[model samples]
Target: MKAKVYVTLKKGVLDPQGKAVANALETMGYKEVKGLRIGKFIEIELDGASQKDGEKRVKEMCEKLLANTVVEDYRIEIV
Candidate 1:
């Protein structure tokens, strides 16, 4: 099975990297972008009996190591 995890900074967390990118874009003439936030997407392959199992394992992975629950939120998808 294949799993994808998306990890993102929680609302109200300061993302200096994102801010810097946004500022650079604005300077390059992309003023339409009012805000920006950076996030991570991780893909993993596993031998799961079913999609449900894959999702369960991926969620656990995110909660345990892939993402910091105190500062980040995550979503898991199995394919």
Candidate 2:
């Protein structure tokens, strides 16, 4: 089984890095770039787990370590 996790800052959180990237893009003449946000993508491989089980485990991993629940939200996908 394989799983993917996406971690991103929640609304209302300060994203200095994302802002910086957006500014750089604007400076480079990408004026259509109105906003940007930074995030993390994690891929994991699992052995002998069904799709349901894999998704559950990946969710636990995100809650425990992969994402900071206070300011970040995560989404999980199993394949």
Candidate 3:
């Protein structure tokens, strides 16, 4: 099974890295972009997990290590 996790800063949280990238984009002449938020993308492989099991485990992984629950939100998809 393959899982994809997206970990992103919660709305209203400051993302300096995102801001820096946005600024760089403008400097590079991509002026249409006015906002940006940077986030983590992770892909994991599991040998024997069912879809339900994969979802449960991936959610736990995000809550425990992949994301900061206080300031970040996460989503998991199993394929």
Candidate 4:
């Protein structure tokens, strides 16, 4: 099984990196660029006995290391 994970900062958290990118875009004349948010994408290939098992493992991976739940949210999709 393959899992795609997205980890992103939750709303209301200060994103300095995103802010810098947005500011650079504005300076470069991208007037339509209103905002920018950065996130992480992790694609993992795993061998599991069943979909349920894969989900459980992926959930553990996200919670234990992939994401910082206090300031970020994560979504996992199996493919």
Candidate 5:
């Protein structure tokens, strides 16, 4: 089994990196860009766990380390 975790800044948090990228795009003639946000993607391999258990473990990982839970939100997908 495999799990994919997505981590991203929560709304209302300052995203300097995302802002910088938007500014660069504007300077480079990609003026159509209105806004941008950046995030992280992680993939983990699980050892033959049931779907329910995999999800539970992944959620724990997210809460413990994968996401800040304060300034960031995470979504998980098991496959």
Candidate 6:
């Protein structure tokens, strides 16, 4: 089984990197750009785990280490 995790800043949190990229895009003439945010993507492989178990483990991983729960949110996909 494989698990994919997406970690992103919570809404209302400041994202300096994302802001910088957005500014750069505007400077380069992409005026339509309005907002941006940065995030992390993680992929994990699990051997012999059922889908339920894989999802549970992935959620734990995100809560414990993959995401900063105070300022970030994470979504998980199991395959």
Please name the candidate that would achieve the greatest lDDT relative to the true structure: 5
lDDT of 4 by residue, 1-79 (tens): 8999999999999999999999999999999998899999999999855888898899999999999999999999999
Residue-level lDDT of model 1, residues 1-79, one tens digit each, is 7888899999999999999999999999999989999999999988846888778778888989999999999988888
Q: Candidate 3, residues 3-63: lDDT per residue as tens digits? A: 9999999999999999999999999999999899999999998888889987998898898
Q: What are the per-residue Cα lDDT tens digits for candidate 5 across 1-79? A: 9999999999999999999999999999998999898999999999978999889999999999999999999999998
TM-score of each: 0.95, 0.97, 0.95, 0.91, 0.94, 0.96
- Candidate 6 per-residue C-alpha lDDT over 1-79 given as tens digits, one digit per residue, 9 for 90 to 100: 8999999999999999999999999999999998999999999989988899879988999999999999999999987
lDDT at 28 for candidate 2? Answer: 97
Q: Cα lDDT of model 4 overall?
A: 0.94
Residue 66 C-alpha lDDT in model 1:
100
* Residue 45 lDDT, candidate 2, scale 0-100: 88
Number of the top TM-score candidate = 2
Give Cα-based local distance difference scores for all models. 0.91, 0.93, 0.93, 0.94, 0.95, 0.94
Report the C-alpha displacement of residue 12, candidate 1, in angstroms. Answer: 0.6
Worst 10 residues of 3 by lDDT: 45-54
Look at candidate 5 and give me any clashing residue pairs: none
Residue 30 error, candidate 1, Å: 0.1
Worst 10 residues of 4 by lDDT: 47-56
Compared with the true structure, model 1 gives a TM-score of: 0.95
Clashes of each: 0, 0, 0, 0, 0, 0
C-alpha lDDT of candidate 3 relative to the true structure: 0.93
